[model samples]
Target: MVFLSYLFVLPVTLLVAEVALLTGATTLAGVSAVITFGLGLITVPIAAVAQGYHRAPDALSPTTAVVWHLTSQLWDVGDRIALEQRRCRLRSCMQRSDQPFALPRRAVFVFTADPADAHVRGNVTRSRARYLYRLDISDTYGQVFQRGIAVAIAGNVHATVSARRTLTATDVPTP
Candidate 1:
């Protein structure tokens, strides 16, 4: 019975602890204390039942399952947000090329441009069948701005593109 408990219940408890640690749940300190102080009591009975023994173990089982459950939920949420951000970026890029595209409320006017540049012209040609170019402008923030010049070519294509900029303390003055 003791051997069965050690082999089955003991290992399962340890495995749960390992999973919890890997998923950023329980700390090593907590796992160590919980397992050291109570794991035996918790696994012993299950082991005894499997082996037809009448007695349970002396220690309590560590609450590793709870930690694993919570960590899994956190991981799921993080994954969802990441996916959403990617989708939003792609949508923004496409919207910038769409005709009659309006700037997002939070977006400020930076500048304007004609689709005569080689790069702009090419992008328009590639997307011409899909969109009617209305107006192309750059913002003060160096963000590419475009509006729908004609009817919807495909679905709704409205996007703005922004370039990376370095900011200095002089860019913003303290009030």
Candidate 2:
């Protein structure tokens, strides 16, 4: 229902904006029209989510590029990322330290790309996610982020406030 509404609303809204743009609509006026539709004002996202379709980060993947950019920005701002369902936080992201060998601590997850994981778990397919790196976490709740490897079945990527690193600018960089 929400998706169908988006299909109808997004294009119609875009069409209006384009028409307005063609007519030399001012920026404020364009914003007003888009706001009038009530999707809420969508500014440039400071961070983005790719909904894991894989179980770990693929360095060669275009998705990795997106993650690289997004994660870099997040690191700059010192933010933690949530892996949707599992809601695990990615801190001190280390790439390719070890292969993920077991189900992540929070298989409280849903697969979006592979229907198999979804079928087996009865979760809505969102996409694949993987551990991009291997980092040790204090894990007070004892939930590790897929053992620091990405896995399949994550969706709705967004930045979070969980377990961020406590490094200051003067801290010695890890070797």
Candidate 3:
């Protein structure tokens, strides 16, 4: 985070210094400002790549990619934003009806024996599972993944979830 910030701030500050040197606005030496601005501008790309940030994919616009990247990294589950999650038995679960395609969604919730489970989904590489994550979902890529657990899937959401592989609609745990 700090590295990316420095890449931008340093250049702009050098630009100001360059302007000051050219206009004789400050008593600073001219050679130093030119060298600083030249070095900062040249290093921007190297510094950005070194920090592991690059251009967005061809499909997405630059602004959209930036907004999504920021949203995912900034609005985390805790602190200013409170995203609730729980580990249940996954008594019953399904997907949204109006989605465009059938694939495993990014968020999955476990259903316990109760009727009114809170229905909280968590990120994939997340601790959303009770013992072991029986069900894993990745809505961003339009897919659903599951382990060796049985579930009762209802509603048209089932059709969308099984878009790729054949998912068992009745994966109940053995007693």
Candidate 4:
């Protein structure tokens, strides 16, 4: 978060230094400003790349890819903005549902699960086993929209389907 704040703050600092230099500031101060600006120029891109690299591994996950794709398709706002703002979260838990199996959405498979695990169940003994997952995208001011998903695991195979999507009341525009 500090790095992100630095990205926004550095430019304004540079602008202030430029103005001071033009207004007959001391040469020492001017030199210091130039050095600071030069360091910022080198560090900004490095910070940006490091931030991106942190998220890159998660982007390769099938679940993350499907969530992003679905957000682009079903969400009213731009997915890129949500992604760039880091407002998306993926959460999962083992659960049971009586709903019948539906066709899996394209590329929604995450991974196989063990059927014998009492906690996971995995739909092997009975078709009621499912993994419940939620994808949440929040607006700049903290209002959140959420999508619920169910991944049914049968033996070593698993498939995911959207269960529901909900927008927070604050997302509705005021009259």
> For residues 1-175, what per-residue lDDT tens digits would candidate 2 score against the true structure?
4445556767777777777788888684577475646653221111111221233433223333222111122332344544344443443131221322322223323221222222322222112221111122111121222321233223334432322233232232222
Q: What is the lDDT of residue 66 in candidate 2?
A: 27
User: What C-alpha lDDT do the candidate models reach, one value each?
Assistant: 0.30, 0.33, 0.30, 0.33
Better of 1 and 4 by lDDT: 4
Q: Which candidate comes out best when scored by TM-score?
A: 4
Q: Is candidate 2 or candidate 3 better by lDDT?
A: 2
**Tens digit of per-residue lDDT, candidate 3, span 1-175:** 5456656766776777778777887755455566666666645344433432122222222221111100112221222221121221343333333321333222322222111112222221123222221111221222222221212122111111111111121222212
In model 4, the runs with Cα more than 4 Å from the true position are 1-26, 54-161, 170-175
Give candidate 2 misplaced runs (Cα > 4 Å).
Answer: 27-29, 36-175
Candidate 2 has its poorest 10 consecutive residues by lDDT at 43-52
Where does model 1 exceed 4 Å of error?
27-37, 40-175
RMSD to true structure for each model, in Å: 27.0, 16.9, 17.9, 17.4
TM-scores for all candidates: the values are 0.19, 0.25, 0.22, 0.30
Clashes of each: 24, 31, 16, 0
Ranking by lDDT: 4, 2, 1, 3
Ranking by TM-score: 4, 2, 3, 1
TM-score of 3: 0.22
Candidate 1 residue-wise lDDT, 2-116, digit = tens: 6554577566667777777777778863665477447565444444344321111111112210100000112221221111222232322322322222332222211123223
Model 2 clash number: 31
